[model samples]
Target chain A: MKTFRILGRNIRDSFRGVWRNLSLSLASISCITITLIVVSIAMILSANVNNFTSQIEKDVTIVVFLDQNIEEDDIDSLYYDIDTIQYVESITFKGKDEIAGEMMEASETYDSIMSNWTHEDNPLQDTYLVKVTDIDHIAEVAKEIGYLENVSVVKYGEGMVEELVSIFDMIKNVTIVIVIALILVTAFLIANTIKITIDSRRREIEIMRLVGASNINIKIPFIFEGLVLGVIGSIIPIIITCYGYAALYTRLHGQLFSSIIKLIVPEPFMYNVSLLLLVIGMVVGMVGSLRAVKKYLKI
Target chain B: MDQIRVQGVTHTYKSGVTALYDLDLTVEKGEFVFIIGSTGCGKSTLGKLLYRELKPTKGTILVGGINVGKIPNRKVYKIRRKMGVVFQDYKLLDKLTVYENVAFALEIFGLPKDEIHEKVVKALELVGLKNKLKMYPRELSGGEQQRVAIARAIVNGPKLLICDEPTGNLDPKTSMEVMTVLDEINKLGTTILMVTHDINIVDKMKKRTVLLNAGRVLKDYAEGEYTK
Candidate 1:
């Protein structure tokens, strides 16, 4: 079709424009790359904090101690009661004798003193170790269990909970603010690039209009130009990030990524997902430039 | 039938004084008409109205039976495709070769490549620029550049070709040469409407001359001579 030929001509023209305005094109791309890099870092840190917190929460368990004199029926009834609560993920019933024996085995700490106390003479109380559906609701759950009949004490990992939560909140806020600022910067930079390019070609655009070139035809080349610049910019950041992460990961864990500290122990998938920030950066650059051309060209 | 009509047209700039006032004129099909006026007169404004570039603050202009003033904004592009426009400045795309400039209009119409190449070659050859097909606009002499512009305009074989002071910036000898080409193109039956202040050139043609003074048609003379 004739439209195909025109599109081809415009593509070639746009390619030529990128080279002709070398300094402006470079400036625009650099602005985009820097903005993307900052955005990518924010993304990486956000993932890091999320992974770190979830790991801590999944590892920590709530321990609820019951009175030693509690009957088997009362224990079973309490178990059923706690099981029905929405947040109670799963519960493990540890008899006092089982707890004291496990404690003695864990203590290379006080083996001689701890071994002197037999399972029959165990001072450790019977406890229900509870896991929650999510870490954030642990305090409310602990309070509920503490008030239950026959429950002597309910211990939530309060200090760890506070630390993980504050870190998670901080990571989220910082990531959002940084990403917003970077996106705004990218948009401003790309818009100025398009505006400058259009300014230089004002005479040509007007003449094209004179010859009955529709606004759509006049702008296709410039939009293509912006796309080319954005794509190039995106590649630069990706290469640098790939190399940076590759090297850091090598020093930290393998050729692909340090998968484990020990050969047998595997790293989490979070590391792989973190590398996706580079892809996020690329998409950001591409979309940012496209938006710039769209806003100004207005076909 | 009149291929072009202007009725009660008046134009005033932001300065609040009329440039053209209550002008009325018509040109039949295949007519070669010249509009002549002094510097302060509305010769250029009338040319713009004919092409629908500047709408008269009050009046109506019709070209090829289309009421240009009442044309909807979206359809303006369709109306323009039916006409060729040339300017004294030549307005050539400096970046494009002479051949590409001529082909631009057909390309805008999304004509097939084979058709564009065939027509572009024909148009350039008609304007006597076939040898300079690869030459950029900046490389050509002023007269030659204007010829390229002419080549571009007629490439589409538009129903109406409106030229505003097509020779204003040229030397006397070059001006006459361009006029000869305009005359030659006219003989082929594409109606030519030219606006000029060049009374010397106007007197030499003496075809259908419409004399515009302060926006009104002061005279309409067939086989008309240049007049004060």
Candidate 2:
């Protein structure tokens, strides 16, 4: 019962402290707001980049062209050899006639040019479409398949896939670093603002000590006040993260620039980001207040 | 019973200046004693030591039978809660009203709200500031502020009340008004150890007086016998 009363008093005092030091409290809140906004943007960017990378990994496939004169028995042996390599997820073989038929269906020009070509005169090569388990090891898998008997050429957009993946990886890493740095900066900024508030109330703290207030009693209100400021500071960022991301996802039609580079769906993603913003605000606020209290207040 | 017992108490500041040299003193419960001396005579230092604000470099001091010097800094509030202290500057919280200032003392202890309200009102009434409960410290005069400080000090019903020049910032007339409140409280059975350099109050109160010179007890006077 007594503990509850003390907690109740501390909570009440925390609110009163914020109101009494409105300008200082607002300074702290605004600091948290601006930094958390940046942090939310970084988180969204990182999440979307990860989404785009995974989509690319899922869609990319290696195309292995067989020698035009290879015998059916040799083609079957080459397909079995390619399947034995590690990281080879699945492979589908397309006969030359089937390839020619696909080309004819794709365009009127191809249909007119290929209508007169019989199977004997057709020059298109039979190909194997290979998918790999890991995109990072796609090049190695393609090389192993190229070494197979009767294989003429191997292609999986070689250099372009590697470069795109590397760039996406860099973007994800930078965004993470940016998010962490912003949280630290917000904590430091709140600490200084709370320090000034504590400095202004030095005499009040002295009187409290003289009047028999324990150190815990003196510290709890200030810490709670910091927590309150942080939570308030995060409100705007959370709102922006939830609504802005959903709105952007809608405006961009679920993709950026093209359908190949897709955005994360808004459903649970925005809610998760909002939760993250709130937690960051709360933890940063408490840490900042604790630092100010420990360093500045003698008690 | 002795409310405060100091034996061979010596206090040396961190700057190497010795404030008190082997001082010994005692005040019985329900007794009112005045500690008077010239400036730099360590009268305020003694008051601070009694309240455990400054630990003696060498010696034992007991307040309400607790070894105050042995209590660690974190547990200092346990000893502080058993006694009250009034400062020369009044030290009323600027943000709190007279009623809230008095209520703050009880609030720190987590007393029930109704009990706090009752005690705050009674404490204010005793100090003759019941009508000014809503006034902030800045709105009050010197005497009223001091009375509010007194009310806060005694609100917890501490056995010992240490006043370190409660009237240092007041005029003579206001000083007497504040002194009257202390006298009334002392008569009601609270032990008071007041540190003051006010010659006029010392000459008039005629209570038990202890005079200090160079941090040593120069003279001790019984009630109705204190002289300049």
Candidate 3:
């Protein structure tokens, strides 16, 4: 009960402090809001890029065309060999007849051209579609599979896959740097803002110290002030990120260059992002106030 | 019992300025002692040492039997709770009213609201400013503001009250009014250690006087003693 009463008083004083210095508090809140907005935007971009990269990775598969004159019994051994490769996730066999049928069904022109073709006359070769666990390791896996006996040709979108991987890597690195820089800048701005408040209240703190107020008693209010500022600063950015992300997701859900690429779904994605923004805001606010109050609280 | 005991206490600032050097003084419980000194005579430094504001560089200070110089950082507040300190420039929060200012001292201890109110009212009543409870610091006169500061200091019923030039900012008449409040508080058995440059008040009060000159005690006298 005593602790609660102290907390109540601290919170009350924090609000009083905030109200007493409205312009400075507003500046702090604005700084946090702007910083969090940039942070959230970066997070959303990273999430989307991650989603796009994974979709592209899923579409990457090496097609191994078998020699037509190869014995049928060797197919099982070939499948087993490809499956044993470390990076290969799965390998599915497609007979020549099945490939011809799929091609004929996919296009009317192909259907007309191959309408009269029978199983014996089909031109397609038996193939293995190899899926790798990681896009970066796909080239290595495909190269190893190319040397397999009875494998006539091995093909994967090597150029496009390498370019996508590098692009995603660059994006990830830049996002980390940007997020770290933003956090430091936010902490600096917020700390300086809280420092101004502390400067104004220096006499009040001195009196509190002289009058036997415990360090915690004097510090709790400023901590509460920082927390309140952080929460207020994050609210607008959270709202904007949520609604804005949902809108962007709706507009660009399946509209990427390739049908296989996609944006992350809005519900869980925005929920997690909102939670992240709030937590970051709170931590940044607290840390900023803690650092700012250290010098003034020597008493 | 000795309310304050300073034994060879020497205080040096971080900038290598020694404010107090081998200064030894003692004040008994309920005694009103005036620490009269010119500027930079180490009078204010001694007052700060009593409140554990500055630890002595070389000597020990015992306030109410506790070694104040060695009091840990966490226990500093506990030591301060037993004493009240008033400053030259009445350090009252401008945003707070007179009533709130006095209550602030008790509020810090997390006293019950009603109890805080009663104590604040009584303290203000002692200072004869109970009628100006609603007035802000800026709204009150210089002497009235100092009275509020005294009320704040004494509201917790501290055993010792350290006033570092409480009347420095007041006129002769106003200073007398503030001094009367301190005297009244001192009469109630709260030992008062007042550091001041105003020889008029010190000579008029004729309390036990300890003269500090250049970080050392020049003279110590009982009541009714006067010095030029």
DockQ (C-alpha based) per candidate is 0.51, 0.66, 0.65
Q: What lDDT score goes with residue A4 in model 1?
A: 85
lDDT of 3 at A233: 91
Tens digits of per-residue lDDT, candidate 1, A1-299, equal 67788888787877787787778778777766776666556655555555555666676688999987788899999998888776999999998877766766888765667777765566778889999987778888888888788999888778877686777777767777876786677667666665665566677767777787766776677777776776676665666555665565556653223321121111333344334544444454445445544443324
Candidate 3: C-alpha RMSD after superposition: 2.2
Q: lDDT for each of the candidates? A: 0.77, 0.89, 0.88
In order, what are the TM-scores of chain A for the candidates?
0.79, 0.84, 0.92
lDDT of 3 by residue, A152-269 (tens): 9999976987898899888878877877787788778777876776777778878888888888888788888888899889999999998998887678764566566677888888
Which has the greatest TM-score?
3
Docking class of 3: medium
For residues B1-228, write the lDDT of model 1, one tens digit per residue.
889988888888778878899889889989999988778789898898888777788888989999998775445667778888999999988777998888877876778888899999998888888999999999999999999999899998888999999999999899988998888888888899999988888888877898887778888878655554
- TM-scores, one per candidate: 0.88, 0.91, 0.94
Q: Positional deviation of B29 in candidate 3, in angstroms? A: 0.6
lDDT of 1 at A112: 69
**Candidates arranged by DockQ, highest first:** 2, 3, 1
Candidate 3 wrongly placed segments (more than 4 Å): A70-73, A251-261, B14-17
Q: Identify the superior model by lDDT, candidate 1 or candidate 2.
A: 2
Writing each residue's lDDT as its tens digit, candidate 2 over A188-271 gives 776777677777777877888889988888888888888888889999999999899989999999999998888999989999
* Candidate 2 pairs with clashing backbones: none
How does model 1 score on DockQ? 0.51
Which pairs clash in model 1?
A253-A258
Residue A266 in model 3: shift from native, Å? 1.8
